[model samples]
Target: MTVKMIAVDMDGTFLNSQQDYDREKFSQLYQVMKQQGVRFVIASGNQYYQLKSFFPEIEGELSFVAENGAYVVSEGEEIFTGEIDPEIIQEVLTILAKFKQGHTILCGKNSAYVNEDEPDSFIEHGQKYYHRLKKVPNLFDVKDDTLFKFALSFPVEQVPEVLVQLHEALGDKVIPVSSGHGDIDLIIPGIHKAHGLMKLQELWGIKNHEVAAFGDSGNDLEMLKHAGYSYVMSNGQPRVKVAAKEIILSNDENGVLLKIEELLGN
Candidate 1:
């Protein structure tokens, strides 16, 4: 099938175990795709700054669907943004306060805010994902920023329980999805990677059938389903493998690039 755009999830689907890739090969592949008018979109549950850091050479050339689709950036500008209502944010935080088992990060357009009460280890771990992180006295007290989502980290075993409680407490007003690595993201209802991708498709006049997507986790589910050519990495979660149209090699083997190369007839 003819592909006009490609969206890839970062952690397990694109980046290898070391969180790096073949720079030279990717650069060459990007150049060819650009010349062929194929858009490359980095669709991740990561922050925009974190995602941008990976593609310095092509910073303004690609699109970013960050925060599990709460924010969308293109050409160095925010084209679309989905934020949780303040009331809902407060309610969610209240529910989280009861559990007291995870570290909570208030994701905003400007920065990610962590409560001062969190352990030092949690802050350090959060810094690995959130580039512009701020330690605040209280998350709910932080204002004047467009809050997109709540990123929470808990014990891997507790993820299932957390998701269930979140859904029960928040009802259909919020969306809770696991992003792997013992993390769960709470976004506004109906907002996700696929929603963010649809915005880009509308902006570019592209269609689902003209797009190719790769992903490896729960957060990448909607995105995979939105594309006609969906690829689940060999190392992806079992659910993702079942949802995808095809399965490719693991990220450690540079499977994403290999598939793209084959698509380009390299």
Candidate 2:
């Protein structure tokens, strides 16, 4: 199938376990894609700043669907921005405080906010994913910022119960999407990577049939199903694998770049 735009998920689909990719190889592939008029988009639940840092050479030539789907940017321009009500954000902060969710981060358009009391481990990890993070005395006091989503971490075993509690407490305000590993993103309802892709499609006048996507895990399910050509990494969860049109090599193998090379070669 002919593809006009290609979107990829970051965590487990493009970056490997250590969170690095073959930049030189990707640069070569991107040159080919640009020449063929194929748009490149980074679809990730991670912060837009963090994701953009990965593509320094061609950052302006691409698009970003970050904070799940709360923020969408194309070619250095903001296409869409979804935010939660201030009252609802306060409620979420209360609930998380009750749970002692020290790993929770209040993501905003300008920067991500984390508790100053959190462990150093959390701070270190947060720094890697959120380039512009602030240590706040209290999340409730965070004002004058457009909040996007909340990023939380939990033990793999506790995720299910935590999700149920979040659902019952938050009701329809938030949607919890697993971004793989122990990370869970609490995003605003009706906002997701697919919504970001839809925005891009409208701007570029492209159809789902001409779009290709790659992802792996809960948050990626919608984007995968939305694209005509969807691929899940072999290292992805079994359930996620079924949602894609085909399975590819693990991220550590640079499966995404390999597949793109094959597609371009054809």
Candidate 3:
């Protein structure tokens, strides 16, 4: 019951289905943790901009593990970062461009680019998930300096096939994992949500057991398993539920905040 740091996931773990950030209870719990000197780290598979959507008011206080733990930003500073080899990212993009004609989302630092082959909802969802992003006519033609990750959206049943094809094509050089239903994220190997949380743990001088983590998707598996105290959403994948130390309420029930109060006894 004496946790020194709380590392939370973003999408399904913290936010509700409507994608609105619930502030009242969460803000109060955050104040309690602050008074106890326990740090809060937002460890997620999202980019920095996407993660920023959750804590717009207290931007400076939140630390983030972005792009599936390949990057970390603390107190508005870059504490840890690992980039996918530019050549590998470009190669994957080219191959996917040829093989799959579906929408391709190019994830970078602050913005993500998507080809014109997406539905209007895709853009709107991206806008909702990320604080800022751009949908362009052609993503491949854009000359960006670096890319953190790339993703493709297809039917849930087809995701495994797509991921297998991508993994076979790219091999071990790039890390390919799922974001949630119908989406797969290709990031650099060794960079995951758990890795990012460990970085924050080091920064805050806390041990793994002193932290409690929550998540609800495939990308969250590694992170959830690594936490001293871990939870999976009631609506989470079967595999994830099995791996977690405990199962909590669904996101709609404000499960993350409920667990926070339970663990810290606030």
Quantify how close model 2 is to the true structure by its C-alpha RMSD in Å: 1.2
> 165-205, model 3: which lDDT tens digit per residue?
87888788777788886877877787888888888888778
Q: Which scores better on lDDT, 1 or 3?
A: 1
Candidate 2 local lDDT, 61-172, one digit each (tens): 7899998889999989999999899999988887777666537999999999998988989888888889999999988999889998999998887877887877787788
Residue-level error in angstroms, candidate 1, position 125: 1.2
TM-score of each: 0.98, 0.96, 0.92
Stretches of model 3 off by over 4 angstroms after superposition: 117-119
Candidate number of the best TM-score = 1
Better of 2 and 3 by TM-score: 2
- Ranked by TM-score from best down, the candidates are 1, 2, 3
**Total colliding residue pairs, candidate 2:** 0
The lDDT values for all models are: 0.91, 0.89, 0.79
Candidate 1 lDDT by residue in tens digits, 171-204? 8777889998899988877889999999999999
